[model samples]
Target: MPTATRVVCEQLAPTIADLAGNQRLVLETIARDVADGADIVVLPELATSGYVFESAEEARSVALRRDDPFFARVAELLTGTDAVAIFGFCEQSDGDELYNSAAVVTATGVVEVYRKVHLWDRETLVFTPGSAAPPVVDTAHGRVGVMVCYDLEFPEMPRSVALAGADLIAVPTNWPFTDVPAGERAPEVIHAQSSARANGVFIACCDRAGIERGQHWTEGTVIVDQFGWPIDRASGVARATADVFLHLARDKSISPHNDLLADRRPDVYPKGAAR
Candidate 1:
């Protein structure tokens, strides 16, 4: 029998520009989740710096380097466990660039940092777009893929990581509340389900709750299984958690003849638009 991985997505409400407060919240949340036997804890995008920045300078003010001692602190919380925590932060590069990035932290340290490739509305004005591909890190629980908010909107982004043998993809998002039809699910949740089903991989999206800068959030934190159905969902400062067999994601067969990854016809697809 395959061992199930306990995945938890904390729907936190981070205060905008309150770096110190947000950091405290993240630490406290991680500690509580760790104690609760969470194998993998995921937090919302910009959990450290918060979203809705007033200026690039403001965002830069809370940006942290990969080697920041804060990560070491996070690692300490998981010192004796095989737990992993994935969360978003404002990343300060060596140069003048600041990136909307996510960090994969474990008992050892910060293992991988993936900068958000697709910047949303106002994000492009404040942060530089990442040129590197999203990462798939081998974690104690499973093979985890990391990406920030807007990156999950693009089909190619999820497909890229899924092709890289990721068992689960962690998405930290701060989804602005959008009006939806009655009895309908949020578009973001639908995207997650579609992505998970198409790639045959589990997806855990951690979304922030509460209003920030007069902007309300969707608080659409969800954990979807390999078959694309939502296993759990979080509401207002709560968490969505589920135990799943991560190894099952390795199987891509939807039908007896069709294999999700193996059936791709890359050669037939267009690389770029024709002039």
Candidate 2:
């Protein structure tokens, strides 16, 4: 049988300084997705703490260390279920450094983490830049990689993980409105499509919305299939909810004699060529 996995993307409006409320929403979303038979659940970046901080002091107030009890609570939400939740948060390392990060949690344990490598404006003032590339994990669902908002903008970000054999890339993003051509989807959504098509991998992007501290966001949450098309529901509409099932192992071949991953031209490419 071709391997199949169910992916869920949630678009939530988080309030600044309301950790309790944000926790409730994420827990409830995961419970709902689990009950619906989803294998992987993704929440937007900064889901634990709202984005847009006035200063590093404010960000530090909400940043959390890995040993923080908050993760234990998040892991408990998946107990007795085979579901995995991927969500972003403000991280405070033991060394007193902060990072914009995301974590993978299962009922049994916390799997892995991906700190945002590409920091947007103002984020540099608060969170420290992650020095490593994205990571791919082995799971029952498949090899899944984690990414946060701005990192998706660079092609190498996803390509590196895809080369490592990622079947799906779960991105937790806070996409703000940007100018796009008329009659076109959000540029970020288009980038997601391009990333999947170029690498022949599925991508599930969960984006947050609503204005926070005067910063507005675009709710462009989407689950793209391995063919880089938006997954559709049984009702023939775009699967725009938290219960969509996806078949990640299908259609990785581009043509009768061509494979998306097998056919590469790295020899002719320069190592430090401009992107």
Candidate 3:
């Protein structure tokens, strides 16, 4: 088990429809985080291609294939380090379909790609929803799970990954700003906190900043501990950093008499509930 893993979530403002510039921004961000000793770095959803597209054709224009050399450049940045980078991208599948996906990358290359299962608002109009479940990849740092924005809002999504033995859940989100009461956190951040506490796993949600196509974002990048408290949160466009023992998440015991996972009454619960 690893001792303490340094995790970073960067809140970047990506320009809409500028694939080259967005890719450059991603590379520079990763390089800087790696130099700063970030074991795991996460970026917002659609980091490669900005969200809020006017049309599907517009999105397809900036979509990248899994084998795009741009990913190689990202891997090159981690050449001698054990660092891992997970970010969202507009993916062009082998077929005519386009999906909102998150890729987990290391020095070796892309390890796993998880397409967004839950699309929010206009996203359904532009991309096809993924059929597969979230994936947990074992890395030198720890077991990292990948999920895109809206997926994290679903309780089952996080629980399934936790049951699969994920130490940290990395979420790449482009959350649109919405109304929140005074002295309260964004609803999205609340969801992250709830999910983390319920599953007893660390969750890092990387959210984007700035307005795109007149749509303001929540800029709610947060790192939550297993106890469901916010470890760190990004203000405006910045990075939230935290050093935590990834192995600690393996223990699901909340109290001496209660174990989060072991105490589940799956047999009596609804059939569609997370097992």
lDDT (tens digit, per residue) of candidate 3 on 40-112: 9999999999998999999999999999999999999999999999999999999999999999999999999
Candidate 1, residue 273: how far the Cα is off, in Å: 7.8
Q: Among these predicted structures, which one has the highest lDDT?
A: 3
Structural RMSD, model 3: 1.1
Cα lDDT computed for each candidate against the true fold: 0.94, 0.80, 0.95
lDDT preference between candidates 2 and 3, better one: 3
lDDT of 2 by residue, 144-211 (tens): 88899999899998888888888789999888767777898888888999998999888888888778
Local accuracy of candidate 1 as per-residue lDDT tens digits, 1-275? 67889999999999888889999999999999999999999999999998999999999999999999999999999999999999999999999999999999999999999999899999999999999999999998889999887788888888999999999999999999999999999999999999999999999999999988899999999999999999999999999999999999999998999999999988887886211
> Candidate 2 vs. truth: CA RMSD?
3.1
User: Model 3 scores what on Cα lDDT?
Assistant: 0.95
Please identify which of the two predictions, 1 or 2, would achieve the higher lDDT against the true structure. 1
